[model samples]
Target chain A: MLETLNQTTFLHTVVAIGSFTIFTIGLVGVLSKKNLFKIFLSLSIVESSLFLFFIGSHFEVGKAAPIVADGIKLFDGHMVDPVPQAMILTTIVIGVAVLALSLTFVVNYYRLSGNIDIDKMDELGEVQ
Target chain B: MFNFEITALGNMFFGLTVLVFVSLFFVPNKHRSVTLYSLLFASLACIFYASDLITLFIGWEIMGWSSYFLIAKTADKQTLQKYIVFNIGGAFTLLGAIILIYGACGSFVYSELDFSAVPSGQVTAITILLLLTLFVKSGIMPFHYWVVDSYSQSNDLFSAVLSAIISKTGVFAFILIFFQIITVQYLQTPILEVVAWLGVLTSIIATFKAINEDEAKRLLAYSSIAQVGYIVTILSIMGSLSLEAALYHTVIHTFVKLLLFINVAAIIYVSKQHRFSTLGGLLYKYPLNFILLVVGIISLAGMPPLGGFSSKFLIYTALLEEHKGLLLAAVLFSSASAFLYCYKLVYGIYLGQPTNPKTEAYPRIPLRFYVPQILGAVILITLGTIPGVIVPMFNGILGSVGFEPVLYRGVFVLGSDFASFNGGVVIGAFGLIFVLILLFFVRLKNRSVKPKDRLDISYCGEVPRADVNLHYGYGMGRELSRIGLIKMILSRSSHALWQRVSTLFGDLSGITQKLYTLSAQNMGLVIFAFFTILLYMGVK
Candidate 1:
């Protein structure tokens, strides 16, 4: 039963469902939260789900990591594709940096105006 | 990256730029910046000499922004806004056309452009876009919303530059891009005819508007628009003679505007007044300025024995050659109406009784101001004396642009096989009559009594009150509004049309603004919804 469940299609299905569930949770948090900080945190959670989905969908059982190490002396088709993983890693780094910067802005904004609720922020003024 | 070449057209424009810029040097203005002016001149030269669309656009943008800064020194916020908006819109259209051409031909260079590969539809689109750009620059009507405000609100000296040099850039580009690069083979005659009508109509309306203007600079601004309109009309004929006619008018107008603007600037400098109501009897105070202004107005009105007439004659002949009888009649109607405003200009400032008490205390105009006026006056007179003198230069330009040179016998005669005139004879006859009149007046005058009090003369056989404003300048063109056709023309304005366009844009942007809420929750919902749609699309 374990051997049968470990099929490529089954793994991809599991990855998709799990990531979709996590993404939905994050989307609910983002939509329900009024606080800017909470919303940003939720956005990060959504980003992580996307990363998991991209990486898991590209992964294959019994495939070597895309690197020339140990038993893998040379690059070959036996290894999983690394481009999507590499792209996700860059995206994660950028996402973290942006999230940190935006949280800092929220902190400073709350200190100045004594509020972090994005709903209450009318600094751009009411649109005519 | 930018390429430039000195064609005969470029050289002619450069020469005109030098003449105008030199005259600008003698103009006294505390706000004047040598750096900005130099930048302007260099950019203008770059535009005139540009061998590619890229270089032309770069120079065009530089010209626009630099002129904005120059005008910003004296213009109000509204005027500056108008100037920037119209000019930038024009520049963007030009950029779009250039991009379209580049996509079609795979090159920005004029010589590399192979329009044969371009679809006729795309060619028309490019032509229209380029024409729109030229129209805005030249302050052609409907696109001329910024012209009056910018010209009048700018410093007196800079106004001359704006009118004389800057406006001509449009004419140059029109000639350069249309005649040389695009070449008239791709152009449709109906489009040319429509342009001709637009030109004549603009002149007619602008002439009436000039008559309505009480301020001197504003009046001259409208006149500048009207004069450029004539050039546009003549140019639309698209023949060797029409091109020559347009070129002649361009040259004459440059000098005419320079002379008139500088003359007005001098008057403003001494009197510290711009309105005609407050300015009168200045002929005796600044006789030289007055005389120079008279010469300018004569040329402006396109009378005989002036450079204006030579160009006007050419324009009429060009129109006749095209068998555009109705258009010629309309142009003549506009030209005839132009005389009313020209007379109003002279009568308001120089011929009437002094309206302001301070006129008696006005000081002598600086000698430097006369330099440009004299230069302009002498050039106009010379051109009037020898109409065909500039023909060789124009012929060179025509030849360079791949057109046959218009026929001309000598420097004294102008025109082709269709019609011709002896400039020398016209000037000589006028000069002789002028001398005889002067001699006759000088010998027979002495019976005229000088009024002790200007209001002492009984008006309608009743003594008018001291406070009564009798300056006819105020009421000069008010009657034109009462006339049926002119009233219809005067009633419509481009301002209302532009205002409606702005409001429409405002409403459109307002719709998009609704989605840009600051609420993080709402923004998150939008993002989530957008992502879901993308995901669904991908999955499908």
Candidate 2:
């Protein structure tokens, strides 16, 4: 059963379903949570799901890692494309930085206003 | 990365810019910036000399922003907002048209785009967008919502720039785009007719509104709009003669407005008063300035022995050449009524008895003020005497834009084959009559009895108090409001219409605002919902 599930088409289907499910859970958490920290955390979860989708969809059964050391002489069809993985790696770094910056802003906001609930933060005042 | 060309049209515009800017240098202002003004002048030259849409647009934006900063030095928040919003909206519309042109022709250069290859529908759309931009820039009606506020609220000296130089940019662009770029072969006639009607209608309404204005600058502002309206109307005719007519009017109006606005600025500088009611009895106090203003108004009203009449005559004859009888009638009507506001401008500021007790102590006007006024007066008189002198320049412009030059018979005579006038005869006759009247006035001065007091006038057989309001300026144009036709004109306000439009947009934005809640969860939900919809569409 493990060998059967290791097929390339089957693995792609699994990856799609798994990542989409994770994305939905994050979306639900984001839409249902009132705390700013939880919302941002859910956002990070969504971002991770996107990274997994990109990396996993590009994977194949027999493709080697795109390292050109002992046997691999050039970046050819024998190895999987490294562009999406590289892009995802850069995106992950930026995501972490953004998340940290945003969390810092939230912490400052909470310290100043004594509120983390987005609904209760009425700094913009009444809509008129 | 920008291309530039030097055509006769550009030459004329740059010359006007230099003249107006030099004159404005002598105008005293506390908030004036040489850098900002120099930037504006350079940008204007860039626009006039630009051979491509990109360069034109870049220069246009710089001009708008620099002028905005200049006006912001004195204008209130509301006026500044109006000025920026309308002007930016105009710029964006022009950009849209330019983008459309690029999409069709794959180039920004004027000479590279061929209108024959574009579809008629696309051409019409581009024409309309460009016209809207020009209309807003020129302060033509319906799009002229920002004009009065900006012109009046700007600092005194810059008002002349706003009226004289900046407004002409629109007319210049109209000529550039319609006459040169599009080349009229692909033009739709009905649109031109509508433009002509719009022009005449704007003039008629603005004339009435000018008459109704109480503030001096506001009156001149409305008058400026009306004069530009005539130029637009005449231009819509699209004949060599009409183009010449428009150019003539444009030159005359530049000096006319510069003189009038500067004259009013001098008065305000001295008295700290600009309202018609408080300003009076200045004719004797500042006789030279008063005379200059009279010359300015004479040209403004399109009266004989002035450059204004030569242009107006050309406009009427051009209209007759095309047999646009009804339009000509409306234009004539507007021109005739313009005299009322012109008189009010003069009578309110100078002719009547002094309303303020402090008028006796107002200081002598700075000698610098006379520099521009004398230059303007001399130019106006010279143009009036030799109206055909500017014909060669206009003909060069017409030739450059692919039109036959209108007939010119020496510097004294001005007109086309349809009709012509001897400028020399007109000016000489007026001069002779004027000198005779002056001599008669001097002879009569010996026998004329001096009044004991200003209050010596018999007022319904009763002695009026010193504080009695006797100035005619306050009630000069109030009678026009009672007339049924003019009342109809004055009753309709573009301000109210624009307010309704803004409120409608406000209501629309309010609906959009419902989607934007401050709560983070709701925003997330919106994002999620948007993505889900996109996913569903992609799957489908």
DockQ values per model: 0.44, 0.40
CA error at residue B414 for candidate 2, angstroms: 1.3
Question: Using TM-score as the measure, which candidate wins?
Answer: 1
Clashing pairs in 1: none
Model 2, B387-432: lDDT tens digits are 9998889999999999999769479999998999999999999999
Candidate 2: chain B TM-score equals 0.96
A6-64, model 1: which lDDT tens digit per residue?
Answer: 88889999999999999989988889988887889888999999999999999888887
Q: Which stretches of candidate 1 lie over 4 Å from their true place?
A: A1-26, A35-128, B507-517
Clashing residue pair totals per candidate (backbone < 3 A) = 0, 0
Q: Model 2, stretches more than 4 Å misplaced? A: A1-128, B447-456, B503-517, B531-540
Q: lDDT per residue, candidate 2, A55-113, as tens digits?
A: 89999999988888876578999788999989998999999999999999999998899
**Candidate 1 CAPRI classification by DockQ:** acceptable
